[model samples]
Target chain A: MSNTLEISNLSKNYGDFQLKDVSFTLPTGYIMGLIGPNGAGKTTVIKTIMNLVMKDKGEVQLFGKDHRDFEIEAKKRIGFVYDTPNYYEHLSLKRLKNVIAPFYDRWDENIFMDLVGRFEIPLNKPLKKFSKGMAMKSSIALALSHHAEFIVMDEPTSGLDPVVRREMLDFLRNLMEDEKKSILFSSHITTDIEQVADYITFMHKGKVVFSKTKDAVREQYALVKGGNELINEATKQHFVAVRTGAYGFEGLTDDVSQTKKILSNSAIYEKATLEDIMFFNNIKTKAEG
Target chain B: MVQLILKDFRVHALLVVICLAALFAASTLYIALVLLSGNGFKTELMLYTLITILSSSAVSLLFFIQDEMFKTDAVFVSLPVSRKQLVWSKYISSIVLLLLAFTAHFFGFQLGVVINNGVGFEGAVVYEGPLLWCMLLLAVVAFKSYAFPLYFKFGMATGGMVFSVFQLLVVIAFLYSLQFETWTDQINAVVVWAEQRSLGGLFGMLLCLVVLLTSGSMPLSAQLFKNKNLGT
Candidate 1:
């Protein structure tokens, strides 16, 4: 399988908000989590890929074809789920299926029905009456039933309860077993991405701070703790960002091994989790000025 | 495309029902008033049919403006279908529904006329039918030029306001045009021609409707929706 999606130098601008030179790729057979802070342009990036919003510059290629050129057919293979369910409030599940099933060439009624049963969504109840988890489940069911090759979800598990979130994550994990399928799931929740993402892309202030495999991210960035006396200009220059206090200081560094070797008798290093990396990166980026 | 049409119908079913009921009630009341006032029922039926056709067309355009422009367009654009399919489906459905509403109202008006006046004034001049057809054609053109563009450019609120302004302009244009001596003469001649040969006038109106619907909606809808910002 090839790259399911390739977005290069994609940019869009609203008076005060701008997404500048944003680029990323999601390879087939893997899940790429787009982890970002609030207002980091994650939704804008997803919308651009779907052509829901116009691009001011750059290109998006899905399945090795330019998005604009293959929009009609390419869209058939792409399914989108937003943070909130976007169905008509008054429509029942059955009515929605009836309305949507005929639009997709690959729509499978049996698969849809099975999903409905599995999710335990009521067919007769209006979407407005559904709970948040149920609505998200229905959205997932619709997205999967179309046999889409690439699934793009913007914050699919943001507001769900622990059990429902676990269920959603488990379903996504199961989905990743198919080598032909790919997913770009965006979320601000580090734990959610940590569990299911094979690769992670960290975006901040409309720019990609980092994009790497989950293993590489965990291996490369590390948390460093040192005494107040060791937290000097020389030591600070070596680390990404130093959070200093009266007793000691802690910092994040890309080269934990090298930093430990240089500061052999000075600091202690520990493996970085996704959350630590994101926090320090944000702090480092903010402190640069 | 058919699925999109069906979905639109499902969403708009309540509004359609209310509009149909209103048309029927208004037409019947007008016919009753004409009979009670001792005015010829057939003449009044002709006017009622004309108003029904015009109002139905205008109302359908209004609904299109409301649905496409006002809310999050994600419901339509996020589907597996193309924008062209969605726009075309709305256009086709609106025209079909408007025509159905007009026909039903016309039939009800004719029935009421026959019951009240016994067809005594069946041959009275009926300018409203042809005039209504002209109005419907104008409504389609107005939708293409004003409402669809507003939807494409500004989303719902601004586009809806623009459409309302355009509708007002259209009415003003019609009233203003009536003041021109040549325009009045031509319109009077067309009305007289329509009265003399009612069947030919009806056929001409049908032809105009076909032309207007075919030429006005397809390309414009495709162009507008193709470039529209669906995220909003």
Candidate 2:
């Protein structure tokens, strides 16, 4: 299958932090979770893709077109949801729709109204009166109204209650039932990603730690538990990061097979979740510094 | 482009109404003062000139303030619209608002005149001529030429502060220049020359300058805004 999104050697500098040669790909018909800690350049990457924040250097392709060169055409096929929903808060949803609907060639008023009704968003009330969940639902309704083939959301689940977030995830899953659309969702909440993402791209400190299928990640990465004495200078290199307690030690390893071979059945291996991978990678980075 | 311009007007309808009302009030007060104080054509002209420039600038600045308040640049950028189109829309919207402000001031002036006539005040002098209209247009366009480039590049908050400082420096320089005999002589010579020129020639020159400044600033603002980062 062709890739829905491709980013290569993406770099941006903000003096205090920098995105260093970030690379990732999301195949068509699959949800790619861009999981990273706060301030880990996830939002910056999304903004750069949307050309909201101009990239210092690199290339981003959307549906086989250079994002910058064919911005209008590329954006026509993509729906964007900002973390804070950057809309005029003094206008009602109905008024806001008039301003936005004309810009998209394929906007469907019927679909928009349907979503609004289902989401229970008020058409007459100004958006400033909307609760956070209602505001997010409004954004989603707008994004989906134009028959967008690709959806890009930056921290859409942040600041949401668990029930609202679950509803959002369910809506996203329902959207993918078409088998022609793709989603790139960025979030610091790993469980949200774990529940919806087919592929996971993990970032730490503005760098891509890994980008792979979720099943591969689960199979290759493991949390090893054993005595503290089991970890030595030679064995430590096998672990992405190691944490020790008085009774025992647990470490995350990317190469589980090699680690198992080295430890020789001395340690028990457990499946590493996305959070575990991120946490261990962060520890490794901090230790290296 | 049209949609974006309309969006600005429709989204900020209340703010626009407030601004127009304020302009009308100011215009009425100025006209009443000109008639009651027996001010000459010169004083009336100066007061109207200030109103013309301020009205256009105030309207343009309000658009920027509203954009910043809502962080709507991000929304615009994400749409299918190009950056150049966005810039063009802003310029066009400012011109439209300039015309609207002029209309408000004109109606306000007429109301003042009617009220004065009702009170048996014959002191009111109306200067309804092509020269006045052309001068107003030049003032509005020239202020926009000065304001938009800075606003597009540095955004409203920072650009506004810089513009204020620049204006202060210009005023200080003008006052300082009056102390020198040569500068005062040159200024007087230019004014005398302008007065000596034919009305048609003066009007054509101001129109040419206005066109030149506007066209030049359009491309500069578009270029600066093209690569700008719309970060919160």
- The best candidate by lDDT is 2
Q: Put down candidate 1 lDDT per residue, A1-289, tens digits, no spaces.
A: 5899888998888768889998888888899999988888998898888878888999999999998877778889988886766546777878877767787999998999998998999998998898899999998888889899999999999889999999999999988788899999999999999999999999988889888899999988988887888777887777878898888888899987778877886777888877887788789878875
User: What is the DockQ (computed on Cα atoms) for candidate 2?
Assistant: 0.69
Clashing residue pairs for model 1: B69-B156
Instruction: Estimate, for each residue in A154-267, the C-alpha lDDT of model 2 and write its tens digit.
Output: 889998999999999999999999888999999999999999999999998999988999999899899999998998899999999999999889999989889989998989
Steric overlap count per candidate = 1, 0
Candidate 1 per-residue lDDT, tens place, B1-232, comes to 7877776677667877787878777766676567557665544554554476457766666456546543535665766667777667766776677666665566556665666664334343342253544544444544543355555556557766777686678667765765665443554576666667766665776677567655775666578777665654
Backbone clash pairs for candidate 2 read none
lDDT of 2 by residue, B1-232 (tens): 7888988988888888988888888777777666566646443544465555666567766777888878888889999989988887888787777777777776677676665663123222323323444455555667566778898988888988888787667557755765665442553465446557867667778778657755788788989999898874
Q: Estimate every model's Cα lDDT from 0 to 1.
A: 0.76, 0.83
Question: What is the TM-score of candidate 2?
Answer: 0.90
- Which docking class does model 2 fall in? medium
Highest TM-score model number: 2
- Say which candidate scores most in DockQ: 2
